[model samples]
Target: MTMDKQFHEILSDTRQDFSGWDFSYITRTGRMGSQLLSWSYGSMAIPLIRKAKSMLDMGTGGGEFLSLLSPFPKEAFATEGYLPNVPIARKRLEPLGVKVVQIEDDFNLPFQNRQFDLILNQHESYSPEEVRRIIADDGIFLTQQAGGLDCREINEMMGVPLNEEFAHWNLETAVMELEANGFEISTRKEEFPIQRFYDTASLIYYLQAIPWQIPDFDPEKYADPLYEIHQIIRENGYFDVSQHRFIIQSRPK
Candidate 1:
């Protein structure tokens, strides 16, 4: 009923949902693997942050966004959808003075109305309208979304067919979505041609990570061909892949 009570309830739900998630890979200590989450924070949230009283990071993966937004807020907090991710996030965030909670439901936000002065979302699942509800009246919401062309180009190059669900990405559509939700766009940036280079084995690993390829490809069967592609890449310096993203700076209209 009360906002604090609701936040506690949401926290409980988060713990349960993320209880079984495998986070070992994400929390691993090393410089060997790429820090994709950190990359998101730097590229998406950093430039827009200004001095603010409080900040909120939605879908705060691995708590990297919290770390990036810390300087902007006197106090910062985060909410994640998965329960398992909460502890992992807290383990990394709490010491840094950021509080984290888990969200149980898909659409509802537990915080009291007008709780945050700034909200950051990178690779978030919320639609534009959903985001507007939880933000303070004058708060700014900064989000970076992977563009539709990014997926389309990847799928085309991978020789895989596209699915209907991945159809919601497009620069025009995204801008329209924000405007339709009564958000006035202040800034927009698109970064592209971001390449992830791979050796033969690494190339195979990369391809295997694609979610839509699941239940469709026999990765084991393509083992040799994957390597062959890598050998080609070796001479070529990198396998070409494009990252299309739109960073939106928005405020309620």
Candidate 2:
């Protein structure tokens, strides 16, 4: 097929509707793939969830991961910042006895002081002070974060500047913030794993799923570059980039 036709075709194919935090569309289909991190966030959280008497999953995207931890504590709860994911999460988790709440400002979480003995946040934004306030003195706050420079190669390839707002966010910064909030870090880890996009459409789909990668990415706006990358993919069979990720587990001092 012609380059123009393939580009338009790829655009149409990847523009399909997406929701929540699910990436199975690309990942499951083998379009996009990522190298394994040194640690497994889910595996690590399982034991913590099983032990806690009461736990809160901050920013539960559609309650997908939370749901996996069945037989939750008597007072299990979850909070989601995105509006669309609220209903989806509630529907999936509420039936299982997990209360799902919609949250907005990270600094002002709507919950009683020291309400939870365990708090989990993966790829979600949170405030150290707010987390400190809501967590019990013995509570564990475990989070896996997408570092400021997560998948920055996409930004460079698309000709967009990196997001400066969170450019300094990393494991060290997070540990410091938690320590300042009177928490003692128990474990901290960081990794930069490779992510491969087997096709140009997979790359486009990824950027769509993660809008913050290139804040104003439009297929048309970056058509030339996208096509160029697509050609590179046709020649190289894959496009690789590094993903920055960090995990921190802490508790109140």
Candidate 3:
């Protein structure tokens, strides 16, 4: 097949449906891979979950990760701001006795004050004050954030705009914010792991799924840059970029 035809075919295949925040397609296809962190978020959260009488998982996308941390607390609840994922999360977690709530905004939590003993957030936007309001006096809040500069090399390569919202959202910044919100920081760490994409197709699929990375991304509109990136991948065997991530654990002051 001609290079143009091959590129189009790959792009077409990569643009498949990506629902419920599941990334099995990318992982199963071996199109993309990332290095592991020193500590696993699940492992870090298990102990906290075990100790708490009530727990809340913020932004539980399809309840995938929350479901994995099984044997939930007596009062297990989850909030999902994304409309489509709310039903999916309910379907997956409700059977397990998890209360899946649909949230209209991140700043406002639909719960009584001091309701949860443990709160977990993974790659979710949050309001520190809301977390403070909902958490019990001795409650713990643990979050793992996706750093703003994650995969910025892709934007540079494609000449797309970078997401600068969390550009300064490091461990220090997170700790400061938590402290400012009346939380005493316990643990914090940050890592920049290398992520590798074996083919341009995987990259295209990722950009599509994560539109914020390149807000106005379109395969047809970016065909020229995509072609150039494809050539680079063919020559180099893969494209590699750094993925910034940070984890913080805190409790009310």
Scored by TM-score, the top model is: 2
Candidate 3, run of 10 with poorest lDDT: 1-10
Tens-digit lDDT track of model 1 for 1-253: 1223432342233321223223333224220133133235465566545556778888886685466445555567888877657888888888877788898764677776678778887766666776777778898888777665563444555466666665567556777888898889887766664445444434343444444433264444544444445455657755555666767778888
Model number with the top lDDT: 2
The parts of candidate 2 lying over 4 Å away from their true place are 1-4
* Candidate 1 backbone collisions, by pair: 14-83, 18-83, 18-84
Candidate numbers, best lDDT first, in rank order: 2, 3, 1
TM-scores of all predicted structures: 0.73, 0.96, 0.95
Report the alpha-carbon TM-score of model 3 versus the true structure.
0.95
TM-score ranking, high to low:
2, 3, 1
lDDT of every model, 2 decimals:
0.61, 0.89, 0.88
Instruction: Give lDDT tens digits, candidate 3, residues 1-110.
Output: 23577887876766657778887787788989999998799999999988989999999988987898888888999999889898999999999989999998878888
lDDT of 2 by residue, 113-181 (tens): 999999999999999999999999999999999999888888788888889998999998999999999
Model 1: lDDT equals 0.61
Cα shift from native, residue 21, model 2 (Å)? 1.1
